[model samples]
Target: MKLAIVAVGHRQPDWISAGCSEYLKRLPPEMAARMIEIKPEPRGSKSREQLLAAERSRIDAALPASVRLIVLDEKGDDLTTLKLAGRLEQWQADGRDAALLIGGADGLDPALKARAAEKIRLSSLTLPHGLARLLLCEQLYRAVSVLKNHPYHREG
Candidate 1:
């Protein structure tokens, strides 16, 4: 199963790219994970709705057909690491590609969130876009590790 992280914004800092890359490399050969960076709409003088509308279009354009969509939002369900690992395993078992959507600075539009198959929150606190990407990559790696019984993740 292919895992795609389709997020708004590009040219992330070198550290962010490197951090995410490290985890991406650790994913199992069968579960190929890739990051698809979409250019965020310029905020400029545009209203929040306008900005989100433009971003929504870009996100929709990047989405792969037949892929299950999971939107990351602050108001979404908060999941434990083990639960996340279970979900990842289920997706792989079902042979479905999963695309995780990360919105830009202004956050995701309500309509877009409504369209996702599932909505999950990484944390209650608002995270910077770059940091959020890094965190997601790390958690994905951790989930893989847990599923494989790798020493990288251990329950206390």
Candidate 2:
């Protein structure tokens, strides 16, 4: 199944891009894991409401119509690494393309959260949005590894 990571914000630090690319390259070509970064709203002197609206608009426009949406939220379910691996397996078994949404620093808009098919949280503590993206990508790679019976993931 195709896996897409649809996230807000662009022009991340070099390290962030390097880290994400490293894991993404390790995945098999058939899995088709891709990172689609929706350009962040220009942050000049815009009001809070205007900024949020712009962010939402960009996110909405970047989302592909066919993929199932899953948002990463602190308020969402926190699953173990093994459970996440299982979840990915189930999605593939069910023949669904998964799109994971990572919102901006202010967090996801209420409408986006409501529209998600599933909501998952990495941890209770807040993490930098860029770091979160890197973490998500790594976890997805690990999940794929586990699903394929690769030696990358070892059960403890």
Residues 1-156, candidate 2, lDDT per residue (tens digit)? Answer: 888888887678999999998988888866778889987777899876677678888887877777788899988889888889888877777677888988876677788788888999988888887899899989988988887889988888
User: Each candidate: what lDDT?
Assistant: 0.90, 0.84
* After superposition, candidate 2 runs with Cα above 4 Å error: 44-47
Per-residue lDDT of model 1, residues 34-138, tens digit only: 999988898799999999999898888888888888999887889888999999988888788999999888888777888888999999987889999999999
Displacement of residue 71 (Cα, Å) in model 1 is: 0.6
lDDT of candidate model 1 versus the reference = 0.90
